[model samples]
Target: MEPTLPMPAAPSSIHFHANCTPTNYSTSPPNSWPPFPLAPAREISSYLNHSRHLSKSKPLPSLASSSQPRTLCFVAMEKKFVEEAGCCYYGGDVDVDGEGRATALRPAALSRPHTQAFHLAWLSLFACFFAAFAAPPILPALRPALVLSPSDSSAAAVASLAATLVGRLAMGPACDILGPRRASGAASLACALALALAAVFASSPRGFLALRFAAGLSLANFVANQHWMSRIFAPSAVGLANAVAAGWANVGSAAAQVVMPVAYDAVALRLGVPVTVAWRVTYLLPCALLVTTGLAVLAFPYDDLEGNRSAAAAAGGGNRSNTLWAVVRGGVGDYRAWVLGLTYGYCYGVELIMENVAAEFFGRRFRLPMEAAGAAAACFGAMNAAARPAGGVASDEVARRFGMRGRLWALWAVQTAGAALCVLVGRMGAAESPSLAATMAAMVACAAFVQAASGLTFGIVPFVSKRSLGVVSGMTASGGALGAIVTNRLFFSGSRYTVEEAISCTGITSLICTLPVALIYFPRQGGMFCGPSATVDDDDNDDGDVGANDDYMLLK
Candidate 1:
């Protein structure tokens, strides 16, 4: 096929200040102002509908890019208002039209097109990665600090686990009701604050558990952030852009290998090992880092062209129950939502099971020290995190080369192969030295390859139904939760099976059952991820016109 075409260049080439001021600032002496390039096409087209609301009587705020700091330019398309043309590198003013948008302000100092959106999406994914690592590694450090026996610790931690499960379940509805952009920003902030507080006050399992629960709530960011990007970028760019984000997220997971160890050491030094200090510090530091990133999200800049579904549609929310039923009953009463959700869940389930249980498997089967085993365990989580983002980008390239449908099949084929390798690992566990080495190698390779599937699973979600991105996300996450818990719970086979054996078995099963589901759900001839050239409004109008102009209407 033709070389994968790059997404269109953003609206502006010149870097300029984009101060987002309400139409009528308190008539106060304006913060320092400067001159710059006019609005980029993105700045104009993204928000046509929102601009109408900006002013029914006045020409929408003149669009101009500013190089100097504190430069302000407002654009309103159909009354959806973005006072700033560019994105903010750091956090600043933000009043989202809905919960679906993960939009942020761009620092007037920076002018790379779609830079703000890309940066925020990456950070959001990073924050999600942060939580992913924190829970598993910090469990040990936290236990002594909380002064709980294993049983008590489990009880307290259960809430956090529940929070993630429930949060995933709830996230989609919130996004559908509120919108992806808004939901993501809110979830990110909520997570940051919860983690921060837990860090400072966590003396017992209960306190930290609460914090974990809060942090888990932010997992919504994974779904919402991707949706936010889909809103901002055209369909063609989404695959590559999301791949980068997902890959970097996994990188964050990989980095956590280093971070978690250092964090454990740092806290132990100050608070002493086997005490609560290390755990508190470990949890607390992420709070600061992630919150700071969340703030940056709040301060991210606008693309001027992208639009949100919720606020645009009267800021009215959806009936989550109905929406969810729709997904289960077949999306819009068809196969769209469940198929994608199942595929994503199946893939997510396989990867997370391995990452979540690796330490237990290795420590028990191989009899390694906790930390040593965990170090190896971190490899899988690290791989999964990095792979998701990179895979997203790779999927996009595949889509560009072969069509979006090809990306789906490609990811499925890879994940299936990885799962097959996992089976090989388990079977070889009781075999010769060659068997063990081969299995281990397979585990590592699958660890990395599976993420591409994960990335594609999520990257494709938003476009399935621009309006239902959140619900779609929630359903997929819900499926993920089921897959994660069910697959792992089977390991509870009281002395029935070894951990590695269980994992290997689940891996094979997921590939066997879910991979085909993905393929069948996304048939060969259909589109997987797509967005119209015009905004949702344009689509609505076109439909309306067709209805009005239908020749059959002559009788009416």
Candidate 2:
């Protein structure tokens, strides 16, 4: 007889089912993947037989409709990925004879929303980074009038921190119950009230403390803001949205630094309003903005996760009943969330100190009076406004080309360089009264790096979560709050005017700790770096819902 093909062992067991456990599936036609250009038509066409001619407008049959394993893989990849992955998951295994290749007999989850909620979430999250000025940077202008020491003025700082913690803890669960829409309204209402109260009761320290706490508690609007933004946009648009938000947040910070001071001076210089009265400007404007945002969102028609639904409808629409606790508990246990949170906290702590207490640091270190130092400190504050967007843009382009692997490494390297340079900026400005231009330039550079780092820090978040942007942001911001607590101590706030020591002590420390964190969390590349990227494939459905990558990326 002519040479015969070798026989291979059959599967331990086999059975045909009416439907897969998870859901129905359609018979995938040949060359089913769109464009037909990315993949050869013959390979897929042969697998589907003649079913490939179905019209594009026709509703796709569910995987549940298919009886064959190959058809189901093509039709129900999203649902079957995890829902059908039972412990005894395998139904069949292809064991090829000597020269033939083997293939898995089990279903696998599909990858979608590669950068979905991330970009949108980043913008809203970045806004918090900048909005912090209403609470922190503005507090200093009130000090001279309040007759409080610069160090003790941090009381408003501490209250806001505590309130922010409250807002975060509360808003997260609220997002689950109230939905993003309700939560945003409630949070903004609170924020507006808090700011108004602070401004109205400018003369009362006790009232001021209470309002500061309220403002912190009110910021929960931010979480809901992020969720809403993420829900509205598609995956591909995520990077750009986040980049813009990152830039705007710095703008908010810059506005706080530069504008608030001028406003304060307006009342003090023009109207004989002392620091307390001048500080009213800081408290009033945020209140107006909060109320306006709250009202506007309430009036608009809301749609969370409506984009690119045709590719994956089931995953795109938001579940009316999804809870925030589900998101938090699900992600808090995640290792990646914690690791990224660490990096955020470390770098953010430094940034917060610069934005909030730099006036004091500059005042004490150089013995410049409070207002002048506060004025000059705007250099960092202003640089941050422009630098953050640039960072986001840079990160976007880099990630698109080299993938997350190259982008993350670059982010850390830049941060490390910037932090080290802070030392130089400080040393140059320390002890000596250099030309005003040089001193301002150094301060601007420091600020630029600070804001630039702010943008870069958020750049990694897309790689962190697929389904749980709210939770991930919460964890990172919460950690950042804790970091703020540590750095806000009196010793760190000492207004000694030596630029070099402050830079070495503050700037360098932030760099050292965050660098390691950036390295650790960055997606691993080719065994060189280990990241969740291995688990997250490049298959964006453009839908709001996440698929398999949700599990791995959510926590770790």
Q: Please, what is the whole-model Cα lDDT of each candidate in the order they appear?
A: 0.55, 0.50
Q: Looking at model 2, report the run of 10 residues with the lowest lDDT sum.
A: 97-106
* Number of the predicted model whose TM-score against the real structure is largest: 1
lDDT per residue (tens digit) for residues 1-556 in model 2: 1111111221212212222222223323234332111112122222323222322223334444344432122222211111111111111222111111111111121112212222333333333433456544455455555555544566777777767656765665455444566666656766677667666775656666666676666545555654444443333333444545545544555565655566666777898866655666646666666666666555433323222221112223355423444455555656766766666655555666666666656666567764576666666666654676666656566765665665566567666666666666666656456455675676666666655665665655644554556666667656666666665552355565333565566666667666555445433332116645566454542133344333222211
Name the runs in model 2 displaced over 4 angstroms: 1-141, 176-181, 202-205, 217-222, 268-282, 307-324, 361-375, 434-436, 490-500, 518-556
Question: Which consecutive 10 residues in model 1 have the weakest lDDT in total?
Answer: 547-556
How would you encode candidate 1's per-residue C-alpha lDDT over 362-385 as one tens digit per residue? 666677665676777777766755
lDDT of 2 at 363: 65
Report the alpha-carbon TM-score of model 1 versus the true structure: 0.69
For each of the candidates, give the backbone clash count.
71, 31
Best by lDDT: 1
**What is the clash tally of candidate 1?**
71
